[model samples]
Target: MEILGDRKFVEVPGTATHELPPLLVRMSPRVRSLERVLGMANDLIEQEDMIPLPAMPVEHDSERRRMDLAVNLVDQYLAFVQHWQWGHSILEWIRQCETTFDTRLELRNLLRADLWPHAGRSSFVVLLEDKLIPTAGVEIEKAVGMRLTFRQPPPLKCFSDQFLFYLNSSVAHTAYQTWAHMIPSPVSSLPPERFQFQVVNMSLD
Candidate 1:
């Protein structure tokens, strides 16, 4: 199966000559520890009645720490997501696998009603801004006021589940860290499609 772009394969000491794209698997212990610190900062912030003004040197310390943690978490997640690769190392032998199935194989079409159970009772908007479009076009207006939902599909089964899993896990961790200070509830969910993966065949062809 050819997953990522075509690439040559090289054997490693303990592994076969698998033609897989470079996988970004390095974990940062500092980031993990920062997550814990962020949680503690959030707890402290929640206990405080108001954000301390900068002029108040004593109060500013905690506030500064809180902001620093949030910013660091976002930065760390961005760095990891940007450089995602899919194999062991430069010399590791791994086969590339491609998606034999159609890309839209498992899309589940959803209606607005499915998403919004209490439409009239509460008001919220789901804005989907496409990156390709230069401006926020008619799609935004059309989706506004009206509850809208769309198909959400998981990656194909043939793809590297490990890659997807790690990507999603990192996103979840980042999202948790980002929302920890602001929201009372735990940040359990990360938006979909934060990371993507492809499969490639081992053959040179």
Candidate 2:
């Protein structure tokens, strides 16, 4: 079996055409269930047309009621589709945020507050990609009764500086040393430069 992109191709003896893998066929039950629901919803909307309204001013009220019912059905269908799309996207965003927060916490623990006293004094802005709109800052004097002077750091620059500083320090070196000790001697003897290089590559990927 050869895998290409999302599909697998298998060459069989005396076979003229490639067939879909068994896993794809196994998913038919779930797919059919969704299709049945969608088909039923469509049929219900269509069924409204079977009820006839009088073509005269005497039945104006009845015609209006039928139109309203049809409109409501269309709205329900649209709402279901929109919710399905938005729900998936929102869930993915939440998962990504959770992962990001966990990694940030780890970094924060490694570079303790004592190491950077200026961190609290400095306003750190969180940037989303290259955009600068949604930046966060502390209202320093808001909590305390006194007027406090606060210095803000250039967002990306501050993060880069602190990260690089820790990477070069003895704490990072010693942490890696301890980690290496727990592993086999052959693995422990691997050069620090190589480990750093591998870390950088993984981060970039």
Candidate 3:
């Protein structure tokens, strides 16, 4: 209150007042899903297409609707992924890590994820690379009904040393494995599964 005295304190309803509870959005670390968002961020930069969001008028109703949908998708992307175990197709799950001691901390690294308040545990973490934040933040702010920007410790800074992996016959199995290594699968109907890793025992200390 004492630092910078500029004008009298009168709250403006448009930007200052809170009228309703904020809507929460949640998302999981699904790389296939967020690729569009990354592309949208690129679009905010040098647009190869002459017609961008603003120039499109209401007459182009279909395009305008698509644009609105994209903004909402980004909002959902901003939300944290709520987890539920025991659901069908629930291959993996870790619980209550933000507040409790994580048994799987040895396997999953919280700081490795890219989202803010990176204090929780997840079986998998997905993050946009640090360099993309500035340009993407600008695009998010441009959303007609949304306002968003990046902050300190940008997303994916948490997921410092990680990489996407895949399974191929070329990746042979060894007696021992480390890092983001692929392991053999026993199922007769399924091929080998690739796994992300966090190695904590390399130090001789």
The model with the greatest TM-score is 2
lDDT of 1 by residue, 2-83 (tens): 1224321111123222222332222221233545544544544445523545565675687676687445544433333222
Alpha-carbon lDDT, every model? 0.28, 0.27, 0.25
TM-score of each: 0.20, 0.25, 0.19
- What stretches of model 1 exceed 4 Å from their correct place? 1-57, 83-205
lDDT ranking, high to low:
1, 2, 3
Pairs that collide, model 3: 27-81, 111-158, 112-158, 112-159, 113-159, 114-155, 114-156
lDDT score for candidate 1 against the true structure: 0.28
Q: What's model 3's lDDT at 88?
A: 9
Worst 10 residues of 1 by lDDT: 118-127
How many steric clashes between backbone atoms does each model show?
A: 32, 0, 7
lDDT of candidate model 3 versus the reference: 0.25
Which stretches of model 3 miss by more than 4 angstroms?
1-67, 75-181, 187-205
TM-score of 1: 0.20
Error of 2 at 133 (Å): 16
Q: With candidate 2 superimposed using the best TM-score fit, by how many Å does residue 197's alpha carbon deviate from the native? A: 31
